[model samples]
Structures are given as C-alpha cells and as structure tokens.
Target: EAGVVQSPRYKIIEKKQPVAFWCNPISGHNTLYWYLQNLGQGPELLIRYENEEAVDDSQLPKDRFSAERLKGVDSTLKIQPAELGDSAVYLCASSLEGFSANEQFFGPGTRLTVL
Candidate 1:
C-alpha cells in the first residue's frame, strides 16, 4: 500500500502571499493528520481527521490556515497571507485509527520558506 504522498517538497514564498500544500494518505487508512514542525522542534498537531470528519483541529491557526479532507481521502492545507513565522515543515500523516499507536505514518513533508 502507498505510504503517503506530498508535493513540492520545498517552497519559497514571500510573506503575505498565500501558499497551499497537498497530501494523499495510505490506501484504506481512515485517520489523517496535519502537523507543523519547526527547526529543532517536534511535530505539532495542526489538525486531524477521521475519514471525512475533522476529529481535532484546535491547534490550527484559524486566522490564516485552513484545511480540508474532501471525500475522506486526499487533503489540502492552505495558509493565506503567510507570515515569516509560518516558515516550517508541514507534515501529513495517516493512521489506521485516530487512537492507534502503531498506525501513524508520516510523509516527507513540504518545507515552506517565507521571505
């Protein structure tokens, strides 16, 4: 089964410009997550989805960030009017269940560079 897929492994954009990233989870997996990782920092949960339902998204910056998992499969994360602080690795992960310990798998991630 496909593990996970992300595009444009790296991105460089000016501050205040909008940016978007995409992810495709493992086939048959039901749980998906989005995380932000800063240099020397652990991945921080941005959002999580169990199939089509967004189970958790408390950490997401509602003022500038948005995400979607349409049809409960592929997902997209967008940051509008990006800020310099938004420069970080945006990771996408998937798991068999939202609470499964050994189910989580991470993608290569998209590193956004805000200028």
Candidate 2:
C-alpha cells in the first residue's frame, strides 16, 4: 500500500567493494524502486520513484545511501564510502503504476561489500 512490495524472494550476494548498481527497466512502467537485502533477510525498500520523481524514500538511510532515477528510465543506488555493514544485495524493481504486487518486474541484484 505504501510502496511496491516485492515477494520474499532470495538474491545471491557475492562479495564486492564499494556500492553502486544500475538498472534499466522494461518500457511502460512508471514506477521504480530500490531495495536492499541482507544475508538471510528479505528485501527492504530503500526508495521509490514515480517517473523521475521520488515519491517514497522514507526507508532509505540518507546518511550513506542515495538513489536516483534519471529520465525515469535508469535507476541507480549508491553508498558513498560504503561500510562493511552495507554489504548486501541491491535490488531494482519497476511496476506499471504505483504499488501493485503483480505488475512489478525485478532485476537481478548486485551485491555490495566494503573491505
């Protein structure tokens, strides 16, 4: 209801330094979202965008994490000077409109690890 909710699916997390992931969603979707998944945990919403406008980002940790959907087409999430605690899988998703569990399409996540 608040935002696009993904099913409790698992994403593989491989070790890597720094934090940045890019996602290109299928055409026609107007909403986009970014999520983070820690080991053994379900994904948590980091931000949500409606076209180039971010409509929801309450869950995002502003101190370190940032996200942007440029031109309403590509979405990128970044963690500046990422910390070890930031290690996790970053997920990108899109939906036709707002929050619809069925209309959402997800991309494979990129795992972040700070060494």
Candidate 3:
C-alpha cells in the first residue's frame, strides 16, 4: 500500500508549543467538521458540530486536541503540547445542511510539523 501524501502549505513548530488552525466556511452553511489526515491513511473525522453544538466528537483526542465553532460559524482547532506523532494535515469542512459529510466545502488544510 502507498503512504498518504503530505500537503504543501504547512506550519513548523517545536514539539511542545501550542498551535491552532482556523477555518471559515462559506456563509450560511450549517454543519461543520474537522478532520485529521496522517501518513498512509485517509482523513479521519475529529469533531462534528451542528450549529454551536458539537453533535459528534467521539473521535477527537480530548487530552491534546480541542475544537470549537462559535456562533455556528467560524471554527478553531487547537493542539497543546503537540507531539511528533501529531504531525498531519488538519482539515475543516462544512456542508450546507446535514449531519452527514455530503456535498461539503473544504478549506485548504494546514499540515503541521513538530520538530
């Protein structure tokens, strides 16, 4: 099997620094989600927010990763004391209306490198 590819746009930081990625979807979209893509794998769902409420966040690693969608619009994903294994692309996506990931518009992901 082939390894997953990395993105061009990136952030380089020390292993213990805090990092945050922001995303603003197209206006009027309802459902929003964050995903993590690592080497040799597809994008993994992190958290899903319906409006200001997070309907599904079971996949999120609560100890280090956190996300929030304020006023059901712009969102932010933060990582505290990031680890080397945490190096990956963070993706933010939104759909017009639904609990599913269908017809979602995705923002350019930011790949993080923990050195």
Candidate 4:
C-alpha cells in the first residue's frame, strides 16, 4: 500500500510563466485533495475530489489555476502565468473517504518558486 506520490519535488519559474504539478493517490483511496502553503502559513485546501468528481474547490483560484482528477486515481494541478505571489509549496493528499476521521496521507509536496 503505497502512500500518495507527487512529482517534481521542486520547481523554479519566472513570474508569468506556466507550471504544473502532479499527484498519484494511494491505491483504493477515493478522496483526493490539493493544498498550498506559504512559508509561514499552514496548508490551505485548494481543491478536493471525491473519486472523479470535484467536491470542493471554492478556495481554488480559477483565473490562473486549474485541476483535474482522472479516473479517480491520479490528479494534476496547473498554474498558468504564475505570479511571484504564487510561490509556495503545493501539496497533495489522499484518504479512503471524505470523512473527517479518515487520516489523510500527504506527499512530500512540490515546492514552487516564482521569481
């Protein structure tokens, strides 16, 4: 039983450039989530998915960001024309379900730096 997996542990891009992150949740997990954390701030949920359906994404910035969970297994998050303010760590997590009691497994996270 592997835990969640994320790609590109670190990324450095100039402001206004496009960048993307990827994640592969644990086997049999039905819930997936994307989060962002600033240097001194805790992670904030950017989006959540129940299987292949997006259950919550109010916190996601639709203007230059987008996400998708394909086949309820793997997911991708993209930031287009990323701004300097977007520099942060992008995290991916997963759990068996959306229940609060279900412990979520987090990946190492992709650290993005927009300069």
Candidate 5:
C-alpha cells in the first residue's frame, strides 16, 4: 500500500513570496491533518479534516495561510507572502475512520525556507 505523498520536498524563496504544498493521503483514510513545525519544536496542528469538512483550523493563520482538502483525498496548503519567520516544515498526516487510536501516518514533509 502506498503511504502519503507530498511534493517538492524542499523549497527556497525570498521573503513575501507565495508558496504552495501538496499532499495525498493514504487510501481508505478518512481523517487528514496539516501541521507546521518550527526548528527544534514539535509539530503544531494547523488544520484537521474529516473528509471534505474542516473540523479544526483555529491555529491556522488566516491572513496568509490557507488549506483545502479536495474530495476527501488530496490536500493543498498555501502561504501567501510568506514571512521569514514562516520557514519550517509542513507535515501531512492521515488516519483511519471512527477516530481510531492507531498512530497517524505522516508524509515526508515539505520544508520551506524563506530568505
């Protein structure tokens, strides 16, 4: 079975540039999540989706960050005019339905570097 897939494992851009990251969750998984991780810190949930509905997104920066889960399968995260402080890893994770206690499977995150 294929795990989650993410694009552009590494990205470099100047400050105030827009960057987008993509993710494809595992087949049969109904819960998906996006997280942001700073250097030397654990991942912080940015958004969570159960199917096409965004269940939680309070931590997401609405001013510059946006996310979407299309058809309950693939997802995209975008940061417009990214700041120098936005340099971090964007992680995508997925798990089974019914809020299973099993560990979530994470993708090889997209690392963004803002200069």
Candidate 6:
C-alpha cells in the first residue's frame, strides 16, 4: 500500500551538467510511467512501461534523455548534459494496466532547475 517515492524533490544544475531522478511505483502495479510538466502545463508522457517492457516511449527525447524500469518496479530518468529548457517537474506515476481508466497516482516529483 505504499505510494510512489522520488528523491531529492528538487534540483539545481548548470545547463550542461547531467541529472537523474528515481522512482518506486506502488506495490503490485504493472504499469509505470514517467512524465514531464513544464510550468503551468499538464504532464506529458515521456515513457510508459508495462511489466518491464517499454510499451511507449515515443515522446522521450532520445538525444539526451533516457529511462529504464529493469524490474518493472523501480524506474530512473536521466537527462544528460541538461538544457535550460529541461527545468520542470519530472513525475512518476503508476497504474494497474497500460490502458486502465483508473487514475494514476503521482509522486511529488523532482523539480529540476537549470542555470
């Protein structure tokens, strides 16, 4: 019955330094997701995993961003050589299934600020 967990909760980095965020999904959930939310905007899916398989990651920025859910329970998102535009909330959410109508529970998020 544990909720999602994230680290640091906040970050400040220069424009070219790398940063990483972590997440642990709810127990017994099969679907995990990473989302990005710019200030004043809704979350946008960066990737989605269904039991260790990355079912959807079309929105992920391949050039400098990457993610993985090796055991399908925990996940990590990395932004290498970060950019000023990368400053935003990196949210992790989980659901029972990939297409479930149920609402996803979100983590507090790692707020990254680039200077």
- Model 5 alpha-carbon miss at residue 21, Å: 0.3
TM-score, cand. 6: 0.96
* Top model number, TM-score: 4
* Candidate 1 residue-wise lDDT, 24-113, digit = tens: 999988999999999999999999999988989999999999999999999999999999999999999998873657568999999999
Please give each candidate's TM-score: 0.96, 0.79, 0.88, 0.97, 0.96, 0.96
Taking the tens digit of each residue's C-alpha lDDT, what string does model 5 give over 3-107? 999988999999999999999999999999999999999999999999999999999999999999989899999999899999999999999976558689999
RMSD vs true structure, all candidates: 1.0, 6.2, 6.0, 0.8, 1.0, 1.0
Kindly list the per-residue Cα lDDT of model 3 for residues 8-114, writing each as its tens digit: 35899999999888887767778888899997898999998888899999999999989888889888889997999889989888887755536867767888999
Task: Give the C-alpha miss distance for residue 45 in model 5, angstroms.
Answer: 0.4
What lDDT is reached at residue 89 by model 4? 98
lDDT of 2 by residue, 31-52 (tens): 8888888989998988999999
Error of 2 at 22 (Å): 0.6
Off by over 4 Å in 4: none
Ranking by lDDT: 4, 5, 1, 6, 3, 2
Candidate 6: worst 10 consecutive residues by lDDT?
Answer: 94-103
Q: Of the candidates shown, which would achieve the greatest lDDT relative to the real structure?
A: 4
Question: What stretches of model 2 exceed 4 Å from their correct place?
Answer: 1-18
lDDT of each: 0.94, 0.73, 0.82, 0.95, 0.94, 0.93
Q: How many clashes in each structure? A: 0, 0, 1, 0, 0, 0
Question: Which residue pairs collide, candidate 2?
Answer: none
**Model 5: runs farther than 4 Å from truth?**
none
